[model samples]
Target: MSSMLSLRNVWVEYGEKVVLERVDLDIAERSFVSIVGPSGAGKSTLLRLLLGQEVPTRGRILLDGVPLKPECGPDRGVVFQRYSIFPHLDARHNVLFGLECAAAPFTGRLFGRARRIALDEADAMLAAVGLGDSGHVFPAHMSGGMQQRLSIAQALVKRPRILLLDEPFGALDPGIRADMHVLVTRLWREQALTIAMVTHDISEAFTLATRVLTLDKRRHDPHAPHRYGATAVYDLTLDRRVAAETAHTASITIDDNVNN
Candidate 1:
């Protein structure tokens, strides 16, 4: 597959402190990539770069061979560790918020036919995230897993080319995290999404990611601790045969149901 995103010799600095350094990476289309490292390893910084929330001090971050803008756009979506859903809006309305914001930035409200279409899309997205029956419920009323699912739904309602996750399942329990792993993998295949997730869990990184990238500062000096920043110390691609088969089987089931 062609490269969907690339970071060429990227570096980031916060005043006198450096966060990332000499980062060169490329992500292929529709690939699930997970980033793992110790604390303050610049994993979340990398996601922020991809999200266009921060600009690199040096080098380039490219999407489809074009330099990405500093501002966020429709092409990139994100889900953070915290359930980033609206507290005031219900599940369905939260999903609709993305469509609303994209369609009308100043006023996040739709009307008439546009409103109907957005509602329909929101319903489909809620169903896709297994929150169909929870459309009327608020995020506070839902479980952690359910809230995370709703966050995913809200992000995907825009059909972004890339999804950036920052410790998406960090707060969930083991069982719920496992369920989220399956849900994310299924969604990646079904939606043909290119994903970049940052997590501290080694197992979760290995389980959900086709490619794993480790970021940490390579050089350490007792006298000068903050001289250097984190780099991509390890990049490994796993065998995704099992994931492929699972997605294929699910696709077949859907097709059979549609045909029947």
Candidate 2:
């Protein structure tokens, strides 16, 4: 398999506070991988690096064998943990936002070729995520799962080279999370998308990832506010089904969440 993304000897620092040191990773094409670790382990930070949301202090980040953009582009789509969609915008509009932001002309803007294509793509993606008929509904009125799904659809509509998810199912209940897991799995199979999702829930990582990457603080500090011991990366393609099933047994507690 060809490599879709790579991080080599990467280092991240926040004003002298080092987050990750000498981090290296490679993401293969059409693979669904998850980043798992304790809080402040640089899991989310890894997603940020992949999406080009932040610059690494050292090393390099690449997309399609090239460097990434400064603030992300249509080539990369992101679904944040919190519903990042506009509250007032309905599901269709939310999906359309990504297209509108695209460097391409007329996309998701005025009525024309770009608008038509953007709308059509959004419709297909929404349908794929089980939001076909809910395109007209505002995200505020939709269930948590529906909102999360819309965020994913919006991310997928643009055919991004890599989809970055930050704890997408973190807010859903156990049953709903399971259902959404299936939905994501089907979509991944259909589109052959390259995904890198950050999740604290080990079960979600196991059930959804082609690989599991455990991030850790590369450097040791006795007084560090948060210290991650060591990064542990695992390959799951050899036994994804087993990993998923075994992961389900350790579903994170979601008593207050809703079921599918």
Candidate 3:
């Protein structure tokens, strides 16, 4: 598989504090990558880098072999743990916002034929995320899962090639999180997206991703904790079948332990 995104010798430093160092990675096209790490290990920072929201203090990032722009581009879309949507707008308008912005930067609104076409696209994307009937609903009226579904639709409506998820399911209940997993998996497959998700859930990381990466510091300074930075210490690629089997076995083991 060809690389869709590449990072070479990437480092993120804020003053004397180093968050990440010597980070080199290649994310293949259509691959689902889950990033896991301890607190302050730079997982979210890594996602920000992928989203073009942050530039590494040292080194570079490349998308499709070209140098990545510092600004967030339309090619990359992001969903956060907190619902990133317009509370005032209905679901349809929230999803239509991106298209409108892209079409008319100055006005941030589409007119007549263009507005109609954008609305149709937004509706289709809402349907794709199982929000077909909720287009007119406000965020305050929706459940957490529904809000997340709307968030996904909003991100996907723009037809971004890469999706960046920052602990997207962290705030949801287990059942809701499971449903989101199914939704995200289906979207990833159907959209042929290259996804980079940051999560604290190990099971989720292992279950949903084609590749799992663990970031940690190779060397730690006890006196000055920020002296060293986290890097990808473990990079494991899994076949879909293998990932399923492993996740299943893990589930059984956890269940048995709980019962015992």
Candidate 4:
């Protein structure tokens, strides 16, 4: 219920073009927030700001009431639409890489007892993502769903406080996307993670998120579209009971479609 992330009058501009302006938001701890908007609405840009990959052109961003760092840190983990795993490494090793990087930044490797422990943790994370038996499988041999599970495992191995998802299931088949929906919902509950996901699907936004945010330009300039920037035009907070009902209804709808 406490605020985990706060953006105060944030703005992101590039030279003469403005992307986001006068954006103010407060994301609570352990809350699942879904961002939905049209193309060029700066949805991904907002996600990047939260990931510490980009800083605001003005205003301040606070994490747990402290000023956020300018670089990405272990406290936040991100899963992109494309699988961000190493093709050469197997599932276990791919997950292990995160631990190794955090433990040994200079060499990005571990050894002996440390190596064994890290592998155990990696296997545990893989199991959590339903890839326990596939630890030895290479990503190239795995199906799309399996590869995405591996990607989630890799992001989660570091045990980040916040998880940022950018159209993570957009590329999957409908059946696979439904399965991933269940997987992500379960993980979000089990891990008690604060998730901020940018999605193109309106149904997905309502189904998975405790809060839904729509970004768009409040005032458009016909002469110069770039003269204005997008902001949170609509913010809707769903009650827990309503969110559960929505998820249930969505699941049934997906099941019916798949059956047909």
Name the top TM-score candidate.
Answer: 3
Pick the winner on TM-score between candidates 3 and 4. 3
Model 4, 67-107: lDDT tens digits are 99999999999999999999999999999999999999999
Ranking by lDDT: 4, 3, 1, 2
TM-score of 1: 0.92
**Clashing residue pairs found in predicted model 4:** none
Model 3 regions more than 4 Å off? 248-260
Question: Which whole-number lDDT from 0 to 100 does residue 43 have in model 2?
Answer: 80
Which consecutive 10 residues in model 2 have the weakest lDDT in total? 251-260
Whole-model lDDT values for every prediction = 0.88, 0.77, 0.91, 0.92
Question: Could you give candidate 1's per-residue lDDT for residues 110-167 as a string of tens digits?
Answer: 8999999999999999999999899999988999999999999988999998999999
Q: Model 3: clashing residue pairs?
A: none
| Positional deviation of residue 71's Cα in model 2 after best superposition, in angstroms | 2.8
Residue 155 displacement (Å), model 1: 0.6
Every model's TM-score: 0.92, 0.86, 0.95, 0.94
**Alpha carbon RMSD to native, model 1:** 8.9
